[model samples]
Target chain A: MTNNSSGSRFGFLIPVIYIVFLLLPIYWLVNMSFKTNSEILGQLTLWPTNPTLRNYTVIFTDPAWYNGYINSIIYVVMNTVISVLVALPAAYAFSRYRFLGDKHLFFWLLTNRMAPPAVFALPFFQLYSAFGLIDTHIAVAIAHCLFNVPLAVWILEGFMSGVPKEIDETAYIDGYSFPRFFVKIFMPLIASGIGVAAFFCFMFSWVELLIARTLTTTDAKPIAATMTRTVSASGMDWGVLAAAGVLTIIPGALVIYFVRNYIAKGFALGRV
Target chain B: MSFSWMAWTLPTAIFFITIFALIAALGVWEYFSPGGGPRVGILRFETTRGDRLFVSLLGSAFIHLAWLGLGGPSLWWALALSVVYAIGVFRFV
Candidate 1:
């Protein structure tokens, strides 16, 4: 009994320590966002001595700053929605069908995701420019889809496969058409999987900087890109940058919170 | 002004429109046909489409990471290696 209790206590300590380690960067960002640049340069403190909302004030007041957030949210949402929608059918195809070159095709799709975003950034810019797509939220959204779609398909496929084949057969016997069955029966069964996939898609698109930066100049600049502009002739606005970073983390944190229960299974790709 | 979408650039507008179009197309395709058959692949285990996708994606990530870690002037080589790796994954993994 004593051994088990000690082992449990040790396990608790491990996660507690891990959580603190993970939170350190975030805590520092929040901490710095409240401090003046002079104070930030002057000392290292656990918390700000004179917490100020000045950093946030700059972000909220500046159209350039706040617009970046809006642009980012726009593309991120568009990308997530597009990725999941497209991936649903593709994932279903992967989970259930075997067409010619199906394996090769699926693999090829994933390889697109593996290619460095930098490699595609220039090409994406050129392609979008040819179509006159520069500085658009959609340009970033579509560019991000290159990565997010495959990931969504891969994640959702795992969840879809876990579902028993018998369910489809039974629904068919009940005379439910494929579309109806898929919408009413199959979708609900895989609701958690969809949530998990959407969460990942949102996170990936939100944090992605290379393609987002390359694809947009100003009209649709992402918060990540906007934050980089803080470094000017004068110097870095560390406080404002830290505040932007804090704001950037909020969307991802909110997503993880909403899908907290399914995240473990999502990470496992539904294998667990 | 009630949320002036006119402030958005042409490319941004097009990009969004394209996404909606793609989604609509996919929906149409799914409605017209159904997918749910399994097949044996080059892999030892009988894998459906999803399994191969998972393996390929997982493999591709490693391949890119490895290529990056090896330190090269251009990622073009990484892209080439990834294609080969992807083919191999589809054919055998």
Candidate 2:
């Protein structure tokens, strides 16, 4: 009994240590963001000697810096919305139906997800150019959908399959039309699935850089792309760059915070 | 940094606004008539109005892309095709 208690006491230590390890770089980035460029380039310190908000000020005040953030949010939101909207029905089809070659088709969709973004970047660039959509927010949003849609479909399918077939039948028999049933009854039942799917879609589109950078130029340049400006003729603006990095983490953190419960339930197959 | 990158084209702004409007309209419609029950048409699988709308939008995107690839300089045919395709998806898919 004493051994078991000792073992349980130490169990938390592993996760706590792991979390600190994971957080070290992020902590450093936040630390550096608060320091002046000279201090960042000077001797290493555990904490900033003179913490300043100058880096953040530069980003907020500069249109090029701030607009990058706006552009990124626009496309990421667009991609997430598109991905989840299309995936819902596709996931329903996959979970509930037994169509010909359904398994093969599903696997094919995943293969698209697995395909490297680099291979498609040039094609996407040319295609969007032809459509006169180069450097546009929609271009990046649509490009992201290639991967996001498949992932959303896959995640939602797992959750949908967890739902019993009888619930669907019962809803159908209760004088609920298909759309009404799906919206009012069926969707609420699998709300966690939708949340999880949307979260993944948002995360993927938000962090993905290769295709987004390849597809856009000045007009729709994402914040990640804008980070390049720090390396100008003056030299690397370490403070501002670090500040941008710190700021970039906020939206994603907010998303996870909001969907924390759903994510836990999602991983546990909708069971708390 | 340059502010030139900050300005979005009018078309781009209009495009986004139109999409948002459509989504808002969809939400309102769903709220008022939450019972557009599923129906199986030519596609065999059952679909609701929301599902049909989604499918049509997706299909229209592909139609426009295909036109860009194989059709002429004019996109009017593609737009016409998309409208027809959307109607078909609403009626059938």
Against the native chain B, each candidate's TM-score is: 0.51, 0.83
Give the poorly placed runs of model 2, Cα more than 4 Å off: A1-7, A264-269, B1-93
Residue A95's C-alpha lDDT in candidate 2?
Answer: 96
- RMSD to truth, every model: 10.4, 13.1
- Model 1, B39-84: lDDT tens digits are 6756556764445555655676787788789787587787688678
Chain B TM-score of candidate number 1:
0.51
Give the poorly placed runs of model 1, Cα more than 4 Å off.
Answer: A1-8, A261-272, B1-93
Chain A, model 1: TM: 0.92
What is the DockQ score, from 0 to 1, of model 2?
0.02
Q: Which number leads on DockQ?
A: 1
For residues A111-153, could you state the per-residue lDDT of candidate 2 as single tens digits?
8999999899877777787778889999999999999999999
**Candidate 2: lDDT of A237?**
86
- Candidate with the greatest lDDT versus the true structure: 2
Pairs in steric clash, model 1: A94-B50, A96-B36, A96-B37, A133-B11, A136-B12
Candidate 2 scores a C-alpha RMSD against the true structure in Å of 13.1
